[model samples]
Target: MEPPSGSPDLVLAFANTHADGGGRPERFADVDGLRAWLRENGLDEAADDASPADVDGVRHLRDAVVTVLLGHSHDPATDDATVAAAEDDVRRVAARHPLVTSVDRDGARLAPAQPGLPGALGLVLAAMTELALTGSWSRVKACRNPPCHFAFLDRSRNTSGAYCSTACSSQVAMRAYRRRKAGSHD
Candidate 1:
């Protein structure tokens, strides 16, 4: 398949696309490639809507991704917790490149080629780890919505990315249409 874009935020945001379209999980290279990447990555896709108390920062990240990506909300109260966790995960991954950084303290040496992004980050540890370790990584991107939160990689050669998917574009268009119909551009 075509490789993903290069930006870290974009990678994180686009973490859970239905890359396989089989409607079943396991048809992917990683969390991004899994048909149910979001659920698999969060480690709770199969669990019944977990309680917010169980939804720690890590769980929140996955849930928020689901909310933004799938429009799913088993419980709306968990929204805040999910958002916080997602943000933290994004920050942590963004800060450390598994490719180039030494998680160990003593001898500075290149780590073994562990698989996946975390491994890649440990190996390279750079702003461009997503690109250098994975496919051309600089093309990662976030949606261009003011209140909307989504991420995607720009495959366009010109690199003019502004959204996670056409659905979002359509949503914006529909909102605009309603506003125009009502003659109220709020």
Candidate 2:
């Protein structure tokens, strides 16, 4: 099934696989879970070809991507060291498994330079590249609330989105309100 409307397919795939869902983490616990996610994302055709090591590799790459995206989304300016590190991590992975460019009857496309884990990561990286080129990379963000690192697209006109949903936003706001209320009474 497709993700909710307005979300890019690739971002949805990564976010759904890596993020917390309804206060519960949905990360893969084993190869079976990873395979299930692959099936869910219509990548099942390549699932059989992935080994246990490939699954581990894919998970690592996913985490790396999350780190990089979160780092960028949180702050686009003021080059923080952590953001640089996250970017370096992603660059290292991308360099390790580069994507190959090819032209077909339809148009140019990107393919993985290597099969298996690299191929899966290459597809994700290619999607990220597309977002970057289109200036939509900032739209992919991780919720600021601790332990709720759900990735979401900032569809707000001003791009000020900081949480996954109104519920999360309300939760944070309520906490702040209580803090101020308590401080005022002190």
Candidate 3:
């Protein structure tokens, strides 16, 4: 569905994906996909230049998303309420960033935006914006096992997917073993 305008959560969701069943990330990939999502979500469909967004613009916004994923200054006991609050934080960062929005305000409005982004870049931006409004952004996460930075959606029926891969989970188990063994000397 369409995301609220200038929403960071949408941006985050757009930029991050579990690639459905644990694979590489997927997105609009171009204007058509972007427009489809926008239209699906009832967002603005203004024509925008199809050039690549400025490196600093897209990357910094991406960093904001990554920062949140890394749980920057976040309480570890994150629940639904916490994720909702985080959506606002992402919105502010992305709205202030270059490509997302050039203007800043104490309270950003979710209005229809004009589109002019290149295929890949626009696709990413559009998806992220949509994610901000929807709870989809909440599912994006990094592996907790510490070795795997790979991102995934916590879609397990029990809402667990804390490890990126089984190997990482095994590694964490191995470390726990070493720790327990070392503690035996005490």
- Listed per model in order, the count of residue pairs whose N, CA or C atoms clash below 3 Å is 23, 0, 16
lDDT of 2 by residue, 1-186 (tens): 111222357765775576464656555656777777766666665566666666666776676666665664573332467667777877888899787776668666566676654566667777777677678888888776655667778899998888788888888789889999999998
CA shift at 5, candidate 1, in angstroms? 12
Q: What TM-score does each of the candidates earn? A: 0.38, 0.81, 0.47
Across 1-186, the per-residue lDDT of candidate 3 in tens digits comes to: 222454444544444532333455433444454445444433443323322334344444444454456452232444546555555655765454334432356643333243433333444445555554576655666555543444556566655566656887788789889999999999
Give the Cα error of residue 136 in candidate 2, in Å.
1.3
Which residue runs of candidate 1 sit more than 4 Å off their true CA positions? 1-14, 17-55, 59-128, 132-138, 144-150, 184-186
What lDDT is obtained when candidate 2 is compared to the true structure?
0.68
What does the lDDT read for residue 115 in candidate 1?
A: 40
Ranking by lDDT: 2, 3, 1
* CA lDDT, candidate 1, residue 69: 29
lDDT of 1: 0.42
RMSD in Å for candidate 2, one decimal? 4.1
In model 1, state the lDDT of residue 112.
22
Best by TM-score: 2
What does candidate 1's lDDT look like per residue over 1-186, in tens digits?
112233454335333332222242322333333324334434233223333343243333343343432222122333666646655665574455333334445433344233443332332234334364566544554454434434455677776655557876677678779889889644
